[model samples]
Target: MTAVHYWRCFCGILMREVLRFVHQRERFLSALVRPLLWLFIFGAGFRQVLGVSITPPYETYILYEVYITPGLVAMIQLFNGMQSSLSMVYDREMGSMRTLLVSPLPRWYLLLCRLLAGVAVSIVQVYVFLAIAWAWGIEMPPLGYLAVLPALVVSGLMLGALGLLLSSAIKQLENFAGVMNFVIFPLFFTSTALYPLWRLRDASPLLADICALNPFTHAVELIRFALYLDFNTTALAAVAAATAVFLAAAFYGYDPARGFTRGKQTA
Candidate 1:
């Protein structure tokens, strides 16, 4: 099968998913707007009202906008990660996800490619946000910009696998926004993305513990640690475990016998 390894069937899967979304200009513009609104409009107003104190890996007090930049970036990936999954649910309903499933290749690679492609797309949004942040005077060290790529990819995979698992479970495009409200937002808000876990603990021990348990918290922590050129073992461990779980769940969902589907979509 080494001969086949040279072939990037998965890359083709990646491109297809990109093209599928890119063809819709409205979707593209909407995706861009969601994060900018959160960053520029909402975060700025909140920065005045909100007081984010210094936490671990942070040496001094910083603006709320700067403190939450990583989280905001994470938030974009979290939603964008799900966007394509929403598409997957729609495609499954329209009998399209099945077409990609039946290819004569390893199933895991195909899914990985899809996840990576989504991550790549998420990276694009992050850079766009970074550019906007720069224009707004939210610049960081150039190294942080360079280091954030791997974190973006890893964070994307974690969330993308999450999307895959969710697509299989929800089985419908409707109610996705509800899923975001109930699941994704809770994960983001409760995490150290907005405020550090220690600060949350000071406010409430139980809530802090819950945020500590969240994988997205770890994803944010991972990026936060990486951005500062620091290593967070807990964040790394948490992300690794979460990615494994989501990937396992996703593969199980794609099992043909399990009704995820076995054959290609019939045109």
Candidate 2:
């Protein structure tokens, strides 16, 4: 395809996702409400007593709300990624995805467009959450807002790829909710999203080790460092690697010959 063809395809897919997001008012509300609840209700209680010790990208101890902000942002992207992929499952079942896949555009490029669209939506949600947090007095450094964009893009892509991989594997839309809960909770809770690795180490070394290995933890750390105008080579490497692996596997799983769609396509 020519450059114009590729550009138009990307825009069409992105616009479709954006419109869908706009019409789904509850989806937007729920995305905001979840993080807000954690920030306001959960954070208020914890901020008083659960002071975080000095961590990298942090010079002094910070309140629980401050410590968890990046994690909450990552949480938004994580949930959005899964939600976007859930739509992929719905579209595949409804035959819309198959229609799109039949287009002349490359399958991987089409999927990449979808992934980028999801990342864009997640970034908007994240910014809105950050705005609310700012109003509530959990402000980050001004430049940090600009600095965190790249981190968000990378983290969003990784999480979105993970969701895409899961979508390719899941056969029924009904089963997706259960699978999301199974995947989302473990990744979020087991990581440094709510608590640091040092604290986890003190409590349970095994859990700490698990957190260290979790890609979600690196996603959070990457955002955390970026939000303070810092770079985290280790976090960046871990997340980028996870993104590549997840995206590759997702492409494989969507392949018609040997992937999850094989039986259905043959029938």
Candidate 3:
């Protein structure tokens, strides 16, 4: 396809995702509610119990809510990513995916387009969450908002790619719930999302090491640092590498000759 045609296709897919999000007010509300509850209820309850020492991105002591804000942002992206994948599975069942696959555009390009669309939707949700956090007195450097944009995009893509990979492997919507539970809960709970590495280490050194190795941990760290207008080279590198690997796997899984489509047909 020509560059113009490719651009048009990308915009159309993105718009469709956006429109779907708009129509599903419950989805948006649920996404916002999950993190807000974590921030207000859980964070408030933990505020007196958990004491955060001064860290790099933070100049002084911070509240539990402030510390986990980035993680909550990542959580929004994680769920939205899986929701996008769920839509893809539904599309496949309804035969719309076959029509999309038959387009003149390369399959990988089409998949990437869908991934970007999902990321776009997630980012919007993140910003909305941030605004609400701000209203709730969660303060950060003013420029941190601008600096965190790239980190949010990178993190969103990494999580969204994982969803794509899962969707390709899952043949039916019924099976996807189990797969999502298997993937999402582990990735989120094991990461530095809820507690610092030191805290996890205090609990279990082995668990801390596993958390350190998780790409979602790096994604959260990336956002955490960016939220303070700081650079985290290691986190950035880890997330970049994970995104590449996940996207490659998703592309291969969606390839016509790779048995993904054939298996779906037989099923």
Candidate 4:
């Protein structure tokens, strides 16, 4: 297809995703509620028990809520990304995904368009959560809001790519619940989301190493540093590499010759 045709397709797909999000008020509310509960309920409870030392990005001691704000932001994106993949599975079952695949456009490009759309939706949710956090007195540097956009986009893409990879593997809607339990909770809890790496180390060095190796941890760290207007080359590099690998695997998973689609056809 021509460039204009490609652009039109991309726009159409993105708009569809956005509209789907808009129509589903419960989805929006649930996304906001999950992290807010963590910030208000869990963080409040943990503040007294958890003593955070003066870390690099943090100048002095910080509240637990403040420390986990970025992680909550990342969490919003993480769940939204998986939700987008759930929609993909639904679309496949309903035959809409097949229709999308039958288009003349390259499969990878179509998938990328869908990925970008999901990322866009997740970014909006992140900012909304940030706004609520600001209202709740979880403050960051003023310019930090603007500075963190790139990190948000990268992190959103990484998580969304992971969702896409999962969608390609999960053939039926019935199987998704198992995948969510197996994948989402483990990734979130194991990462530096709810607690610091040091805390994990205190518990178990092996657990800390696993958290360090988690791509989601790097995504959270990238956001944390950006929110403080600081640069973390290591986190940035790790997230970038993870995004690349996840996207490649997702692309392969959707490939018709030997991927999920092939399995679907044979079955």
Candidate 5:
């Protein structure tokens, strides 16, 4: 009975997540377009100005669009992860999250279900972005492309869990945009998204170390290696460590005693 109930609850949560994105079709397209614009339009212009070195398997004058594809993919997952969690917070405001929370299943299971849904949706957007990149002359081996699916899933889970943690910590939706703008942009820019770590080292050693410590950097590296069908040990470890930390902190944040839901939870 426990197994039956868990599977059913998982399906329910997944369905709810899919419905939310499906109903807001424009949001998905907008998400895809924003990055593509950055890659095709902005990155193209910046490539001439920004100093970037040739990383392995990229032996010639590579376009910035080609270089940043992995990082851009990471960006999409991270943003979507946060967006999904923000939606969860909105659901709480509208009295829907309480419905899920008060269900017979464990809270962790429900949370995982939601996280998995976010991952599934993220993968779809990622592939769409990849197809666009391919057409734009940004080529990678076909197997390299297929192998990135798991990394994307892991990254989506980690970021989505962080979002869930943030949602649980904040009091209301009003504060989310500030958090998004102030928090997300800094994290993205500081990472190896626009350039490699060595490039940042030349810019400022302090800045380079900060980027090294950033979990998002590791996530970016993880995707970068997977895109090239290479494995980065440091990146895998970092993602794993971040996943553990975020999940723990998020679990604590969601605890009733922590006042995460406060007056928001009818449960």
Candidate 6:
């Protein structure tokens, strides 16, 4: 196919996702609600309990709300990623995925388009959360707004690719929802999203090690630093590497000839 054909395919997939998001108003609301609750309610309750010392991202010590804002943002993207892949499972059962995959476009390109579309949607949700938080007095540096964009894109892609990988392995719609809970809760709680690694290390050294190794922790750290107009090189490298690994695994899983899709095809 020519460049025009590729462009058209990408646009078509993106618009469809956008339109789906628009019609499913609850999806948008739900995405915002979870993080907002964590920011306003949970953050407040824990404000006194959680003491965040000066970390790499912050010059001075910060409030619990301020410290967790980036984590909440990452949380939004995480949910959006899983929600996008949930749709993938639905499309597969409904046979829409097969139709799209059968198109002349390369399978990998098609999957990439789907991933980008999900990232675009997640970015919108993230900015809206930031705007609301800003109004709520949780402020970041002005330039941090601009600086965080690249971080968001990379983190979103990494998380969304992970969702894509999960979707490829899931065969039925019903089972995927259970798997989401199984995966999301562990990934969120075990990471440095709510608490820093040092704190976890204090509680249990082994738990701290797992949190350090968790890719989600790096994603949160990446956003946390970026929002303060700072950089975390280790976080950047870890997130980039995780993105590559997840995406490569997703591509392999979607391979109809030999991967998870093969069983579906045969059956």
| Reference-based TM-score of each model | 0.91, 0.97, 0.97, 0.97, 0.95, 0.97
Best by lDDT: 2
Q: What does each candidate score in C-alpha RMSD? A: 2.8, 1.2, 1.1, 1.3, 1.8, 1.3
After TM-score superposition, the amount by which residue 22's alpha carbon in candidate 6 deviates from its true location, in angstroms, is 0.5
lDDT of 3 by residue, 1-267 (tens): 689999999999999889999999999999999999999999999999998888777888899999999999999999988999998988998889888898999999999999999999999999999999999999778999999999999999999999999889888999988988898899999999999999899989999999999999999999999999899999999999999999999998898888675655665
Per residue, candidate 1 scores C-alpha lDDT tens digits across 1-267 of: 665562567567778867866788787677778777877888788888878777766777888888888888898889888887888788888867667776766777777777887888888878988888889888777798888888888888899899988987885667677887887878888888877777788889999999989899999988887787777888888888899999999888877677653333334
- In model 2, how many backbone clashes occur? 0
Per-residue CA lDDT of candidate 6, range 16-49, in tens? 9999999999989999999999999999999999
Which tens-of-lDDT digit does each residue in 6-114 have in candidate 4? 9999999999989999999999999999999999999999999998888878898899999999999999989988999999999998889988899999999999999
Off by over 4 Å in 3: 264-267
**Candidate 4 clashes between residue pairs 3 or more apart in a chain or in different chains:** none
* lDDT (Cα atoms) of all candidates against the true structure: 0.81, 0.94, 0.93, 0.93, 0.85, 0.93
Q: Per-residue lDDT of 91-142 in model 5, one digit per residue for the tens?
A: 8888788888888777777787888899899889999999998998888889
Deviation from native of the Cα of residue 48 in model 2, angstroms: 2.9
**TM-score of the candidate numbered 5?**
0.95
Q: lDDT: which is higher, 1 or 6? A: 6
Q: Between 4 and 5, whose lDDT is larger?
A: 4
lDDT, residue 148, model 2 = 99
What residue pairs are clashing in model 5? none
TM-score, cand. 6: 0.97
Steric clash pairs (candidate 6): none
